[model samples]
Target: MSTQRVFVARLSGCFVFDPAGDRLGKVRDVVVIFRKDDPPRVIGLVVEIPGRRHVFVSIGRVTSIATGQVITTGLINVRRFQQRGGEVRVMAELLGRKVYLNDGSGTAVIEDVAIERNRLGEWDVGQLFLRRPRTSASPFAKGPTTFASWSDVREQQNPGEAQSAEQLVATYSDLKPADLANTLLDLPEDRLIEVAEELPDDRLADALEEMPEEEQVHILEALGDERAADILDAMEPDDAADLLGQLPEERSEELLDLMEPEEAEDVRALLKYGPDTAGGLMTSEPIVLSADATVAEALALIRRHELHPALAAAVFVTLPPYETPTGRLLGTVHFQRMLRYPPHERLGAIIDDTLDPMPAAASAAEVARLLASYNLVSVPVVDQAHRLVGAVSIDDVLDYLLPDDWRSHDGEPPAASAHPTTATIPRRR
Candidate 1:
């Protein structure tokens, strides 16, 4: 193998293949053990395989680390990866860390770390990328950045101090909100908060919606009340209500009070219903159109990038008041039906009112049956006055129906016999 230097940031998401060229997984992080007086020694690579299982791949088994790929000896330990004493994940724990330059310069943040093969062929931390602190007042401002030998940095600051997640967030920038939520779940609590604080309100809100209720509460509370309220305002009304329902009444009310009146009102209305009911699971912001709306307008609304897939599958037709709790439910027009008609045709001409809309008080079981029987992506919900209130998407229904711990683990790992497993390697204490 060549003794060339490889940056940790570039190694992320690279494909890991066995000798036969069979792809095993993608590189998620690098594990290293710190040394007393020398640089940290690379021990292994964290590989996320099928089923989202994260397993350990020893560096000794790695034949080569080249551009966009890592060749392994085809021996992998299937056990879930766990951190041991003195062991650290280079990307998760070292990146975004606050450290001081050995020189007179005050403070700097660790942007990336590089590892290189030594004379003995063992990979060790060789270089560090650092950036001067950017003012919080101007978040978009770029700070002066410099590179130094690993030994040039003095020491890392206390973990509790202000830390940046700029590099960490940028590393996984291409992940979907749900996948990002899974990645955040792997971080230590304090580190997770730091990353959450750095994400944009809309992005954080989407990820929070995918997380479990307990995690949602923990992260929201960690953020002060004002910020929590802002995040809630960005979330879907139904999801925000579900999370607030998990908090204590006093704390929930305080956060609700801080939110904008219009957003708060929608959440408050949803909170009035039991969580298992159709009203509780439904989003009040579904694509709603008036009777005279043209197919062109409906298509335009469906074309929105931000609309949820299930919600975009159809358009709800109603009377005058286009917003939720709309005047009167006319019917629903599936996306396919709209495409078959002329763009200028009125939606009412092809409305599908054969299926009755479910009442807000309808039970979850009833909603599920309706969706299954009708083979629908979403079903319209109405109030006592027969006015449209919201629409429950299939995704939300599955989220409620799945086991509580489903998010924690996808399923059991592949049988050990399928992949030759190696004994666990002890880490330095």
Candidate 2:
């Protein structure tokens, strides 16, 4: 019934002892189940039995783990342990693997793993200790050990290993879009694009949106005309336009031609404006309604949930037949006012005429100032002809206001080597 924490490295090759202090065998590997939404949990230990085959010992039968010994509850299973599809063996698979820390540091080899049991009595990989793999060992040689939380580390595929693109695709397919994007950034450029090509168009689009602009262009262009067009069509029109704008004009036009006419037209319309202007920054898609539309109708549209919160911040009411490049622009209805109005009331009845729209040619700085000064979450952009072109969200405006390299800096120090340093984790005792 007793429990203790020990690093996987320390546990490996340690003698396993039964209740009566009789040595059984050495610990071979730690088994864990990998799940997308939850931390991996230790299920059992693989221990080599003397003169017999390797067997699985459930953690429930483990009394303690520390130093060079694992004390068990005396009852251990004799059958061999089979690794299931989702199972991972920390000692066998991960111990010597290279990983990238979130701080954009170069790769480090995982040396040991720290495991702890949660309140629910499930052991989870909580921390990792890393060190540069040494070519030779000496009694007097000293080096720094790096300590990091498990969540901050991501496994980087080894290039020297003969891993097929299909295998790599299968390995990364289950990761969340953002996580997959982060892992892809650690890959060499050729491999990055190669692996991306194998992914489903929708998944690839999601991952591409999370990558840096330069990387996005490189991947999309390498995907070729049809695949690139499919992914761009899958992405938000505004995002697709921004990426295409980064490519050479001839290339961009060629890719645009390959895209579905409707989708390509939307992006082409966005590309007309200068990158620093309001039209360039705003999404052409936003929640819009006729002046006579009811509050109930507006709520229904918002409930459909296709629009992001920033995109639905306010409802713009227009005259006559409403469309993307809409008819005569009427007053705007801020989101707060929508909540206060009766369900049956018309949007035009409660619209705010005092809020002026920004011109499409307005500079990014001008747009940021307007949003900040007005305390607005979104502001509409109108062309010289006063047609409703699009709306810019505050988040987009802030991206422009911040430094160009803000994405790279993120206010965190890049991981650099610490010479002759040791981590604060407890030493063997």
TM-scores of the models, in the order given: 0.92, 0.59
Query: What local lDDT does model 1 show for residue 300?
Result: 99
Per model, state how many residue pairs clash: 0, 0
Best by TM-score: 1
Candidate 2 per-residue lDDT over residues 1-429, each given as its tens digit: 444467886676689987767777778678888777666788788776643245677777677777689887766554444556676777545655677888886666676788887667668887788774344588666346788877787776766653235434555556667556755664555567767877889888988876778878878778778889999999988889989988899988998999999999889999999989999998888778998899989888777654668877788888655656887678788877989989999998998989889999999989998888989999989888788888899977866677654443133332322421211122111
What overall lDDT, based on C-alpha atoms, would model 1 receive against the true structure?
Answer: 0.87
Off by over 4 Å in 2: 1-180, 188-191, 409-411, 414-429
**Tens-digit lDDT track of model 1 for 199-266:** 88998999999888999999998998899999999999999999999988998899999999999999
lDDT of 2 at 269: 93
lDDT against the true structure, per candidate, is 0.87, 0.75
Candidate 1 RMSD computed on C-alpha atoms after optimal superposition onto the true structure:
2.9
